[model samples]
Target: MASRPGAWRNILRRQPSSPRKTSTISHISLPLEIPVEEETLPYYEPEHYYPVHIGEVYESRYQITGKLGYGAYSTSWLCRDLQVLKVSTSLPKFPTATDREPKIYGHIAKINSTHPGQALIREFYDSFDLQGTDGRHRCLVMQPMHMSLLEMMGLNPRPFDLPLLKMTVTRLLIALDFLHAEAGVIHADLKTDNQKSTAPPPKQIDESRIIYKSRKFGRPDKAKGYGLPSLCDLGESRIGATQESNPFVQPHIYRAPEVMLDMPWGSAADIRNLAGLIWDLFEGEHLFGAVFDARGGHDPFKHFALIVALIGEPPSEFVKRSETTGQCFDTNGNWVAHEDEVIPTVSLDNLEKRLFGQEKQLFIQFMRSMLKWMPEERKTAGQLLEDPWLQ
Candidate 1:
């Protein structure tokens, strides 16, 4: 493939394997020649999204059939494990040419327990390195999942019914519990994009009119009902405490307040992301959608302004304790409150009514427990499993 002059190579490098990752796109079939720059993807382009065309074979085994999605660090492909009993699974495993994701998959693949949530966490199969134009790239093999919860919500176009919502939340909570308590891992980014179930096989298409992103028989249809939604994209998954000390850990909307404040955070940050994810599931919109700066670029302060509008100010104690609070909040905890003219800074109580449109006491309580301003005060995944709302 020839490159346009001055085209920036993606950020896919030899990253440390264990990290968090999210932001899902549908199993979209684009013309192999379609310009990525022309299409506005959901997340940062060039950084995460990469080009994978039809009939490209990698590691002399797995064949690239389709693109599931990618994030700030990696692009995922649907592949056929030619070496194994042909299995069709999605491997968002190629975001970084490093050992981190493979390491996390290797860790998860060793579990011998049986639990509903276990099914939700995609099983790791294998990995390999591929020769790319830039350099050797690390690719991971995960049990193929169907569509992301984002896609599923789009398919239904409504909040999940109480039963399905409970089931999904319960399973994901259990999975988080396992990752936090048992495996000693932290899925720094937990959102609908990471929560995926098996998707149906690729549909037939005319090669001339449409781009085909799959093999003729890559693998059989992943089973339904018996399937469980699992987390994918370990590019951001980490073990124990976050080895990196940075403000950015997750997508802006799912980002924790502590993260916004440049304060240290832990696994509870994932819980905060989950709180936003659940709300997005029901409302079909981000609790804190993109906030643009004066230059029309992504703005972090605007996001916090919305957070304060909704959840009210962080505890005064928390503000005084934070290292970066001054950047965002005044002594009284106002962060450019009156400067921005537009965008809803709705309260949590209003958000509950707008999202649920009915009695939302249980759901409200459940979100409050996780979305607390103080990361330490938020419930653990295990403790969340016992939430009366979930019950």
Candidate 2:
């Protein structure tokens, strides 16, 4: 059967061998009639083989403990460093991989040989390929973490307290700053699920049973809880200079308007997303949910309804600018403009009325200001950090 041009090459290169090598293998010849590019290839499924058992060791170094969370392309695990004897037993194994052992070993070796410092930063560990046992072939080794922010959010009975919220947001911003300012990288997917907590010391331990401390740190008030939040999951991360877009960024809720408009966005967009996250922390629900019409797909209009409901319709000038940029707008019934020509429109008083009606609008305004359609008009992370609400 013919396959897509790129698809055929990928398949031919990645074909797996049988478990046992045969001395006398039969050769079967087949004719290629259809063009490779036109052939339909089977969907590529991720290998499910997790080769390394609980106590397995790779390269005689890092030891595997257990699985962490799965990312778009990789699975993290908790592992321990064998070289550090003193802290080795005390420190629980951080998240490390148990799948695709050989490939992971090769990657670690290569990284150690080429970029030793960077490899050290990555904390080399082990993963395995359970081809014979299962069929999966990929794995990863990484630092150990406790509950992710998503887990923490679900675990907390009460909404995030103001100080905790600010602390969390600040830490995230700082992480983003380090990525953008120093590393020249962009964390495309920033969400609660990707934020992890540092692992606490283990208490009771056994071959099969291990006791761990709670990730949550209680606040002065018994009702609230907090933890040190650390950013994780860099699979979608890219160098700042790279111009490609990842297809699987967080949903529209966390997406910046510039991204929604299909415009070229940089690190600033990350700030916008962080702002939305902060709002969610305080509101205890997605800020854009009311405006979003799930049935309409991810159209901005769904959010436009929210804008109208809160800040009123966008101004004609704003609409005109949006139109000039080929943005679409809808005028209730009549066809005022093409979908691409329509721009967001609303009056300021309508916005005030919608947002200020009964509930306090200050925080909402803070978030909206950062979500401006025009990138230049939006507030920066530094500016948002100084906002009175946060203070």
Best model number under TM-score: 1
Per-candidate local distance difference test = 0.60, 0.45
RMSD of each: 9.9, 14.5
Q: After superposition, how far is residue 196 of candidate 1 from its true place, in Å?
A: 8.4
Clashes of each: 17, 28
**Candidate 2 per-residue C-alpha lDDT over 294-330 given as tens digits, one digit per residue, 9 for 90 to 100:** 4645656555444444444444444553332233343
TM-score for model 2? 0.57
Scored by lDDT, model 1 comes in at 0.60
Residue 366 C-alpha lDDT in model 2: 66
TM-score of each: 0.72, 0.57
| Candidate 1 residue-wise lDDT at 146 | 57
For model 2, the stretches where C-alpha displacement exceeds 4 angstroms are: 1-52, 80-140, 195-226, 241-248, 290-301, 304-327, 330-362
Q: 1-391 in candidate 1: lDDT tens per residue?
A: 0111111122124342321213233455545444342133444423122234444554455665455554434456676652221112223454333566656655655555554455556655655444433444565556566567776666564777777777778888888887777677788877776422233333223332222232222223545342456666665788776544667678777888777667777899999998888887766677777566667666776877777777677877788867677767677765644564343647777756443533477778888898888878999988988888777
